[model samples]
Target: MGLLPLNYRRPDHVSEEDVRRNESSVEFDEKADASLKSGYSGTSPGIPDALTFDRILNGGACPPCTVRDFMNYLIYIEHAAENLQFYLWYRDYVRRFDAAPASETVLSPDWTRAMEEDTIARVQKDATGKAKKDAPVARELFKGTDFEKAPEARVESRDPFATPPRSSAGDTASLSGSQATSYVSQAEDAFSAVGVKQPFTIQPFRSEINRVIATYIVDDSPRQLNLSSCEQKAVVRALSYTTHPSALRTLSQNIENTLRRQAHPNFIRWSICNGNPARVTFARGLGVGTILVAAVGSIILTLSKAGRGWRALFAILWVLGIATLVAAAKGMCVVLHGLHHRNVRPWELFVEDNTTGLEQLHEGKRSFDSFGSCNSYEDEPWVVKYQRRFYVRKVFDREVWIQEPALRQIQDTIFLQSVLLALFGASALTAIFVAVPAGGFF
Candidate 1:
């Protein structure tokens, strides 16, 4: 039966029609194969292509990774900013408490020197009662104020009974009053003075910073599975500049053009794939992952060894190396240096929100002429109306169409999936190595 089937499959005789059919079939098969390879690999076989370093960002296709990375970056950036602010605050507090001149002291050489010594002492104080009492008042009142100042004014007056009364002394008499009365008048004057004292206004706590920071995180992190246009530019440039000179000239020119056309500084610097927050956020995640993984590995290694000093040292060194590599990868040290240059401690002050007007600008369907050129439209698009009617019919009649966190939800999902998949893959690989052979591996 098998032989008969094989015989039936074989061609009995070669004819023009048969040859044509065979050739056609071969051609079709070739074409299909080519299509499949092209679709899946996106490259010809045996040829090296540009590395897709950008796609690894935010755990490609994983929405949860995207959300996790985005949120983590914001938290990290904010924490860094807060730490910087705290340091600044602490430094100012120390200076104010230590070197602050007596509120009423004259600034002679001795006094100035004494104030300087006092400041030093206050910064390095023992737990003494009197020093502690004075520190708080000085710190609160003179926080971040200049430490050196001229002496307080002295008002010398003659006793009313001792001074011989004369018409010429009328001006002095007019100025004199009971000490309580004078104190009241002085207090009133101090209170009424139009900006006599420099207004100790706290620097405006800009809520805008938070929004910008958030936007920076979101735009920089991975939004989708791939790098955004801006992120592609950054990663490509980074790779090209580091390795290939051929890409430099074209990249530089494109970078210049992009800078001219785009408002973002990253466009000019070729630092991001797209001006979008998501892609940038992903790049940052890559760096963060390396650091975290290294640290975790080191901890696990150290823990695995029960009080072994050499193993702990090796683990520590390995972790440190990983940390250094991560810092190098993400330009963290450079960023820290830049912060220092600006006299900023990144961990001190923080922003709360990060969205720009771009969101508002791009949110809805815009109006356009018949040619599809965008124009300002007073009327909302019918699609919006349809969506409201079909999906949100009850809420459609309302004037404001409050935004749903559709993108955020998507990001969250992707992030979670990526993390789970990664963990699963890692666990499977570990299990294979640890248990598949079922021997003495562990």
Candidate 2:
């Protein structure tokens, strides 16, 4: 009536051989544990000690990480730091430009005064339209004489005929052509005496003023983005012509506002969530799960006596699953698109389809010594092929790769995948229920 079987009884005494064997096993285990701990602490046979998760995460001074995990982490951190520095520099430059003394001239009184003076001069010149019109008559009358050399005193008395007073049109017309000629000559004399130059006009000052204003406006705006050297020179030249300080200050403020409103590059914000191994893994998992669910659902729907609606639903699920799987395989994280409000393709973030030129050489598609055999090929060792078959391409430039976006993209993709899985599960359950025979309600 013992709990243990009769044959399975404990030994009466411990054997020396058995004890020795047990002790040896314990010693071996201890040695193995020690070796493992040592391996983790220092470099292993092939793997470097510096390529640890801790060292990379902590940003410590470690050797080059050959492991993808640490390598990606380092790359991301380096790019992020660089971008941060650039962004800070740009922001500071903008601030300094705004605070600079030259920015105050746009709205200064000098600009207004210059504009007013130019306007008044133009109006005054325009008002002497009648005098300008009479120039032709004077030039014709004084055609033969050096009227320009008329003496300061005798110029007024040089004309013999005097202009008849305008009383009535009949009286004025009554004067003969000689009398009219005499009147014109007298008028010319009077004009010369008064030092009124022929072809009366004023020189243009607005063109120079306008040019200066344009230059100051350009100078006040951010120059680092896309403004060219030629454009900068033009702007400077324009500002040089400007005499108004108020106009310069106003233009400067306007430029500042424009720069502020512009979407300048942000390092920290742009670098978030990129080159994250966890994210890649998660994306892959979701993609695989979706594919499996879709496959199962499709198989069930095909074999079961389900209605057209259910079949169609399962078919759609299958297609969606396949699509998700492809995207995951390519490392295309759709969530990034949603969060960033932009299209973030998979190839931009990860190196995909990495292959060596060996295959091409073997197939006679490329030469063995060809340096640039592939479009993605680079001269660097790190840019080499992976697995002796796949050529790993470099990621996009840091500036192009990162973007400013909230972290919502992470949740968006996860949530979408979860919902899809749930639907698949529900469909499977419904199919199962429908297949079952209708028994009693109890």
Candidate 3:
């Protein structure tokens, strides 16, 4: 049975005649095949597309790879939830600030080079211990192109995405809206200074800015972001003057770069191992098969009148097999992880949620009247949800060919230092086997 092309957009007014006519036409099948090929093997068959990084940074990156998808991994696996959370908030924050009336909003002066100030430098240099290790690497890779400065350049470009996004909205959370009037929680109240007067220029968004600082920009914050000491101070200092998006854009540039460089690639590699047809097969088949055979074999030999050397040998094999299974599960091969490279696999492009917004935008149910003349809502499109790869059949899928690396290194290091210690264990087990002479002969 043929599947609908992933990029297939359901037309607004599809008559019965068109469906019957298209079903019989060979052109339908050809188009579907071509689209699938581009997604799997890149636009040019076998040559990986260079747009991978750019797609990831912008919304609607490599299909199945979206803000929702990455959020799960970053929050659970990496323990760096604050970066993506702050980035999402900033995008929405900036969107609202942009759509606000000129009379209400005021632009702040350049807070650039704030990181270069002597106070910030001293905090970074003197920062030792876990603070130094956990500190965010300064933003460079995605500089200038990021949304903090130029939201239009990347999002507005006519460049084709891995999957076409339905629409974008100027859903800026304006202060005049219900959000500003909503009851301030005790936590939010802590963000504002009691006696100090907020700057009159940015009176509209001063509360929101203070809340952002308390949650993401301040030291000892509940969900503290990885801003340098001086960077944090700079954001606070700039806010005293203006409440423009640029005022705290150091948050934008830094967090965007951090997630793109670190969390994104890791998420991709994870998807490859977990979703790729071949990798899944290799993991379940070989990974499980090896575990059963090695474990059973080791147990049988270990209980018999086997020599210590023989038992030890099987034990090593058993450990190595477990390592292989683990690596397969993580979709990490030492070479690829070390090299920081991955292959784009078939059926892995993200599928956008097309149920509501797109058809409405086309059919006149919802308004998409801005940003390349799109998005009806205040912040983003109503139906911008991204779906992961859909699986069909998996028979004779290719090999993942994994050998896990981290545990292997740890095992080696521990074994080398603990070799003498291991001897004591070996001797203890050897004596137990001797004391309880095996019924079965080797």
Candidate 4:
């Protein structure tokens, strides 16, 4: 809800278990966290890097990772995109519902009270602190809620896995349509409007709710979401009563959690194994390091006058080169790690705070900046997106310091692992070339 969230009136419509996870703070099992461990092989089924799913969801600095990028990965790679598609659509729908004119939103006496209360509560929570910083800056875009700082600003977790706290005792924004005239259109109708005025009230979004139900909630329907009957009914009932976004809230929350828990980790794994920075960075490191290794081998084989003692010294260069190559293979650049900094990807530029000078983050003809734009997924196709190399793209990447404690630990771990691997390789090579009585080329 921290991203200008859905109204958080406790759901009386569904079982408590269904909405239990929707609360503000999540109690994470410390042992289960993959980030706590830094020896990531990019081979774990669980995401083992410093980056967490909730962090990515909260718009953390995971490059080439965005709503669109994730969606494309889901659509093309995982073959499971319905949950994310419906979830995105639902959130976008909520924005329109909020931005709808107040006059048009007056569905009934009961609706007016609930909507007003929800508006006030949402604005109150989003008006200050870290949540407010990333919350929609366009307060003027919303209709009913006067964006004011609540004296005691209710802080919400940015974590999708975490549930927001229940509303106060007096927060009775929850209402049944019995308070309204109960104007419902029970007919096969299309709700195919993407523009602003589509989700207002009776004539506007009842059909859209029906459409969403027909598409995503109905069992075995095309693009059907894996929703429990209770969840589906809650959404149908709430949206039918009024096109308020809170209706879709439960369903969206579940879908969001699903995407975060399952699909996201798989995407990260695929990214590491296939591309992102793994192959590209590895190649760069390998090319440079291999040159040094070749030079060491050439000197050892060609210089017969050199004693075995000094021959072992040449292994030091091999160790350094192999370490660089190995580090990059593990998604770490040894040089960057030593410097305590990393290059920022173009897509990741906008993910930072305003203080990072991201006002002009999007510039190129292929910028993935504009959401709902025609060229959104053209940055790279998902089919071979991760397969993309960094040579041409490195110009877009800027050097940024790795300041986060967790990430710093991860980079250090990778560098150490790389050095250890290099030591082993160097020992083996020196044994064959220097320790053994193998004659030099000369």
Which predicted model would earn the best lDDT?
Answer: 4
lDDT of 4 at 410: 44
Task: Name the lDDT of candidate 3.
Answer: 0.43
Best candidate (score: TM-score):
4
TM-score for each candidate, following the candidate numbering: 0.17, 0.27, 0.39, 0.45
lDDT tens digits by residue: candidate 2, 273-376: 33334444565666677667766765565566555355446545554555455444434444543433322222222233244234433322211111112222
Give the least accurate 10-residue stretch of model 1, judged by summed lDDT: 1-10
Q: Would you list the clashing residue pairs of candidate 3?
A: 63-349, 63-350, 64-350, 96-172, 168-375, 170-378, 171-378, 171-379, 172-378, 370-374
**What Cα-based lDDT does every candidate model obtain?**
0.27, 0.34, 0.43, 0.48
Task: Supply candidate 1's per-residue lDDT for 159.
Answer: 42
> Runs in model 3 with CA error above 4 Å?
1-64, 107-198, 275-442
Assess candidate 2 and give its lDDT: 0.34
- The CA-based lDDT of model 1 is what? 0.27
Could you give candidate 1's per-residue lDDT for residues 29-132 as a string of tens digits?
A: 33543443243222212111111112212134232123222223222321212211222232343344345454411221121324334433442332233345
Q: Write the per-residue lDDT of candidate 4 for residues 1-442, one digit (tens) a residue.
A: 0111122111122223433453334432333223323322222233433455545544664444445556556655655567666766776776887687878656622334355345445434433332345445434344345434532344232334321223332122211222222122221221211011224445456656655655555433445555433333334444545556655554565566556545666665444321235334655556476747656664566466556766676677778887877655555566566676666543444445563334323323222221222222334322243246455565335566654454455455556666777788888877666655535546
Worst 10 residues of 4 by lDDT: 1-10
Question: What TM-score does model 2 achieve against the real structure?
Answer: 0.27
Worst 10 residues of 2 by lDDT: 259-268
- The order by descending lDDT is 4, 3, 2, 1
What's the best-to-worst order under TM-score? Answer: 4, 3, 2, 1
